[model samples]
Target chain A: MSEHDKNTRHLARMQRKKAVVDTKIESAKISKGLLLIHTGIGKGKSTAAFGLLARALGHGMQAVVVQFIKGRSDTGEEAFFKNAANLQWHVMGDGFTWETQNAENDLASARKAWDLVQACLQDETVNLLILDEFTYALKYGWLSIDEVVAALKNRPPMQHVVITGRAAPQALIDVADTVSEVNLLKHAFQAGVQAMPGVEW
Target chain B: MSEHDKNTRHLARMQRKKAVVDTKIESAKISKGLLLIHTGIGKGKSTAAFGLLARALGHGMQAVVVQFIKGRSDTGEEAFFKNAANLQWHVMGDGFTWETQNAENDLASARKAWDLVQACLQDETVNLLILDEFTYALKYGWLSIDEVVAALKNRPPMQHVVITGRAAPQALIDVADTVSEVNLLKHAFQAGVQAMPGVEW
Candidate 1:
């Protein structure tokens, strides 16, 4: 095609796309709290939650983190945000399920974390709440799916909740405003590269 | 099952899992730069990239961000990290391709961004570099895939690079050490909810 003809075609395509996107944006007028779920077997479910936490913090909004399955407190994210006045971070896990090994103990921990989540859901002042690795609790039948969904549905008007883990329940998925599944195509760990600090954890 | 029986079974499973994970961790001893690609049609590809940027910055490492198709400088991330002493952020695109509409202009802009990427690849002091929405340039054929892959392959040994966008090329995937495809199952925008600041942006 001639250069002029190509430019005209490109312009027409863009114009059509712009009109559709603009209409979508215009129609989307409602604003309120959002339930976001990050699930699947890939990395970055929790990492992206931390990014949202950072964005919330950057805006100087009140944010809370209740890490369910990550026992380590020495992660790069914790070290960075633990000191922020607007942030409240709780690393509330014994360790990975395999490391913990006690169903009763895991249940107790899940209940304790749920207690905190309940409180946060009621507190209208909290703008963003991250339930990191929360799906395991639900997946293992440690937390009641109905109770959890009800509490999430009843959260304050503007509070944004981010739930991250693998195998999120259908109920939770149904109620969530946004859901993303991070699928692993390739991993450095499988290629004999260690999961390093800062990048992985 | 009895509580005692359940506990014993859990303990046996835990032991088996621990051994496998330990072996995996032990065998992965190679330490080097990582090429990570975050793609698929999801909400958190760039958000996760920002999270990595935060983690890198948290470690007091020198980091840089070359945003490919995002033209706006007033984004929550740019607002948060623009002034960070450890970061060098350049929003290099005119806008999204549909918005820009000029192929020649976009090609020039992409080339300019590629020039910056090449410079960063050689900078050993830079610990992390985020190429946000970089796949679009490759997808649209604005940049040479062979040349881009070659540059990425030759980057500084310890400089971590993150490339985020949709429909990432197979060539790019082949070169990446870690690849995650963020699959979008649902989004608030589709439900007529406006994209709010500090959360969506």
Candidate 2:
């Protein structure tokens, strides 16, 4: 064979080897124990978290969602997934702490809700645990940061946890494996338009 | 009662009325320009979009999502939500023309895909439309960008569109009201662990 042909073949072989190595590297990811904190002043923090829950359910994975500071007004999420076998929905506490007053009382209820989530995490039956709007509790000093971190650390080795709300605590940020901040630049409502039925809710 | 007590009581009542008014304004928001596009080399774009479908369903609002290039994987989000009176799931296209070499054949299939979504955009029954991986087609020049934009502009007044893919056209970026770019900075896989079943699926 020719010298040029030999060099060309050698380069091709190297390229193929590199690609195989890359794929192998990608396929070996930890693939479990993901703790996601979606924060910042964006409107879609909760929306993004719920989007994750839906993904988990579609894959036949179990999801336990505990919604804090959002127990009223009947958010449509519950109405639709109420019957889905893989979904466990718990809405505890009044719409907001100010509404329920006694921040101390609200804190106890938040802790109780966390306890329910802990059972799912410990049971290893839940694939995804979404603590929707839990950041407010941390911000208001209703939930102990150490307790939250400890429970999360103790989650089933292969399970994932997603916490969504604005102003996430630094403590939560420190422990999260994946942190995404959705910053809201502009919103439709601010532009004098109302959220239409299907898209907004 | 003293005059001071009367003044304090009056101020408190006015504040309560103001609070009620603020909440009404907040609840009255209707999302029109809000759009969600999922573009990444991840396993969950369509899964995320479908989850949005369930959310819209819960709210009693209509949803119309056009699945592009994924007609074969049809595991049928259509079969799941199509029967619901308020849900409109449109799955168009026959897998993809990727392996097909002829330019004419590719364009022909693209045209077919466009036809289904184009009509749905006009129908008022459709509330939200998801263009799954449709961006890749346009990026590859199989579909015309002009035609796509025209369809988007001509859609129902309040209709929201969600486009997902790895590389969406520049025109799309210009037209999109909200765009989120998920940058893959690091992956745990490089270290070595296979994606866990329920977690990574």
lDDT of each residue in A135-171, candidate 2, tens digit only: 9888877778898899889988888888878888888
> Which lDDT tens digits does candidate 1 get at residues A1-201?
999999899999998998988999999999998999999999788889988877777777899999997888778778767777788999999899888888789989999999999999999999999999999999989899999999998999899999999999899999999999999999999999998766987
A-chain TM-score of every model:
0.95, 0.81
Q: Write the per-residue lDDT of candidate 1 for residues B71-131, one digit (tens) a residue.
A: 8877767776677778899999999878888888999999999999999999999899999
Best by DockQ: 1
The list of candidate 2 runs beyond 4 A from truth reads A1-31, A97-102, B1-35, B38-48, B69-110, B166-201
Which pairs clash in model 1? none
Per-residue lDDT tens digits for candidate 2, residues B5-112, read 754665566567668756766775554635666554433445456656677788776776676665453253444455666766555655544323234544566678
- Clashes in candidate 2: how many? 7
Docking class of 2: acceptable
Per-chain TM-score of candidate 2, chain B:
0.69
Give each model a TM-score. Answer: 0.97, 0.74
Candidate 2 lDDT score at position B31? 47
